[model samples]
Target: MADLQVEVMGKDEGVMDDYIGKFTLSVTPGTKEVEIEGTVFKIVMGTFWIKIESTPSQDKHRLQFPYLFDGPIHYSRHYSPAVGLLTNFNDAWLYSTFIKGVPLFFRNNFQLWNRKGPASFAVRPGIQAGHRLLYARAAGNAFGIIEDTKGVVELLHTGAQDDVSGGGGPNAQRRVKPAVYTYIISAEDASFRFSETGAAFFVDFASKHALHSNCAEVVRYSGEFHPRPEGGWQNFGDFTPDDPVKWEFMIDNNSGTYAPDKMLLPEVKELFEFNFPGLVVRALDREDERLVESREACRAYALKWRGVRTDELQLHVREGEVTLCRRVSESGQQEMKRAKDNFT
Candidate 1:
């Protein structure tokens, strides 16, 4: 069992007082399943979901461990000073390496953890550098952060135009200016990166087809469709192939956020009308009633992976402890109980 205190801080060294809280939880050795909303068991699996909020500001921030846990999970609830809403969120995995209990190198890019080798770094629980040490740690690819003797956050390697902040000091937020963004995901492992705006090219793991998308209308570009020479996003809707096979707009929703039926599809239909003037484009989400077969096919394909389904939890602060609550099922609602409590 361990006792922990939590505090929320801003990039400018200002503490969010309202978000400060204390909680205690038991961590059994070799424990397997942890019943957060029910009875506790052994073997805890899946990602850790953490949400922090302030009462006065009313700003709520959520941090969810990545499905394929590699590095730090960063989520920004505040807007950047440069851009209002654009470039507001950044989701990327960073990696660092250690050998023989000494820091070797640190790289902020998409790289898997190097397991099974003579130089494999030690995997241990708790953080040592920060003011408030985090005792709870999980198995993952790389170390989160390491400070040099000089108390400086050192970056041995970084991608092109990679900006890292909050080095050997308190938590700092990275700054990114607003510009055209290019999202490239390999079809093989789904490893993705949001490249710098107007980046000429990128090279990643080998794949038959590379899924590419710019901050443009929802459509897949085929057969030598590149960004326009002029800055900003080029509307691919303006281009028409001489030998057209089929004209269709593809809505990709790997984020799992519901945007197809509400935002992307409607905007795509409008763009199609504006570009072709007379052509009418009807777009639908995969789960739409009209596309029952497609939805079933998608489900079948997903089932092939045998991915575990995680529950959606609601965050609540009750009596100074950070507890997770989940709504009761309809059958249990007759007793007037709304949720089940589980402390983290």
Candidate 2:
């Protein structure tokens, strides 16, 4: 899990800004994935509380981070969640395939499992077939970045050539230049506030498992973020019609096998289960102030049902502060008691 914080303090001038910061990056054992947690501030705009995770696998890593806004995303007026998600996702993929996967270069000689037969990190790239040399070059071309490969092999071969020829000629031993990974984050506005930043990492491709296929293996996938989920894991944010916070607050209001009339009810169930252990709620049509009268009538026949305990239960409100005059026995309890009474 990788957690990072990019804070925007205040715009200075000419694509630069005064920024405050708190960044943390953590990786769990047995998994190459990184979990990230922190806050991001944009000058006088707003704040972002984000919990992002990069899960590395035997074949590929995945990232579908969560971003929460306390105030507003004025820039949010027009933006593609899919595009933003994919843009971030491309970084993870590039790391696993092109950057981290560079070790395959040395392994190609023996083709030992093609460097991909065994999953090294989470979501490992499939062992590329063909020559490692060709694969490296192709991967570059496929991603429309072959200059990277040339730089990679040139760096390695240059070092070897230098050792042999002792540096001489147009092919004179030039220092091997490795591929570098740089991250650039920026924010701009009409008022002329500009803040752009960058950081870089190096990649070594002297591995043996490298593939040699001129055809770059480019993979593309598409999926939607589920909201108000009917089946399972839901992602809630601005896009969701249901407010994530409110849904979390009222989840205990409904539950069971079938659908609940309130669209937010079902989704709330997920939020509740995620936060609390157990919740018991009574969904009475409080709009009918005569609820007590109806409960009383139901209690009158509680004995006829199946299980009846104390005839009825008192509503607990204000945490022992207020006690109401009317209440109804739990239906489940009434049914069980009634059944036992009949059996007796």
Candidate 3:
């Protein structure tokens, strides 16, 4: 087959990036299958690449593309640790050795990761280093970030971009600027930078997708996403007589449940645990508590068809110096009763 060439027009505008990827295929006379041999192609301005997908197809072996750096790598969208390195350009560096005979010679584009956290890997991930880290780490890539003496948060042999605020040192809140204007994710249509008022301004990720809405709420630029007025957020909703103090307690307490959903994505849990175990554990515990609370709360609104689904819960208790374990379950309105005890 002739060399494939793919011309990519960046969805953004007035920009073009090319690719030089590689792929393969082979067929025998009367059969419907073709043996395929694929390889890692390159990502450049306008070159074509190929990789043999299912050469021996149940149908004719007629699948071919001669103009793309990659084929069938569709969700080739996976990320790696090198992304963090790019985001944290704080005097940190990365290195790696090329695969034995590949000509690209340790090129700056490819992505790959093995243990030591996404460093200088072949381009299995993609071009943008930060995106790679965000994807890989969030997607639960096991060997994503490996901490060393300097803690570059690297992969293979490359280094990740250092944290912007030097990693929230000391009293953290005091050391770090309140208004973090940047966001972890990037889109051609959006750009984010921190503000001095402890508020963030940027494109709304969820809002931009489908029927979510187009309002770029002044949300907090943390790991999660939440809607707030443009400068910063100071408290949660208040339901008590003394609105101010009550609001403070709500923010300090239960806001961990629904408010922070924007930052804590499903993909970020493991990395969160690894980087900050205590906080991660606390988050997990909070989640579990919320789940239990929800289950009990549901009882108040349960339908007439709702029946008690009795179950055993092994409880570990300590009364003074004594330790006791017990098993418990739901019965009739007991679930609602338990929920009220917890919140009230």
Of the candidates numbered 2 and 3, which has the greater TM-score value?
3
- Name the Cα RMSD for model 2: 32.9
lDDT of each: 0.23, 0.22, 0.22
User: Per model, how many backbone clashes are there?
Assistant: 7, 56, 52
By lDDT rank, best first, the candidates go 1, 2, 3
Q: Model 3: per-residue lDDT, tens digit, 1-344?
A: 34223333322111112233333334223223222222343323233334444343332223432221211111111222232222221211111111111111212221111123222223212222222122332232322222221111112111222231222112212111111111211111112211111111111111111101111222221222211212212331212222112110001111211133423433233323333232222222224654334323322222211232221011122232121000011121354585689999
The 10-residue segment of model 1 with minimum total lDDT is 125-134
Q: What would the TM-scores of all predictions be?
A: 0.18, 0.15, 0.21
Query: Which candidate leads the pack in TM-score?
Result: 3
Best by lDDT: 1
Off by over 4 Å in 2: 1-3, 6-262, 281-344
**Stretches of candidate 3 exceeding 4 Å from the true structure:** 1-14, 24-174, 179-271, 280-344
lDDT of 1 by residue, 178-293 (tens): 12223332222222223222221111111101213221122221111111111211222223321221222222222211122233445434533333333334445545553343
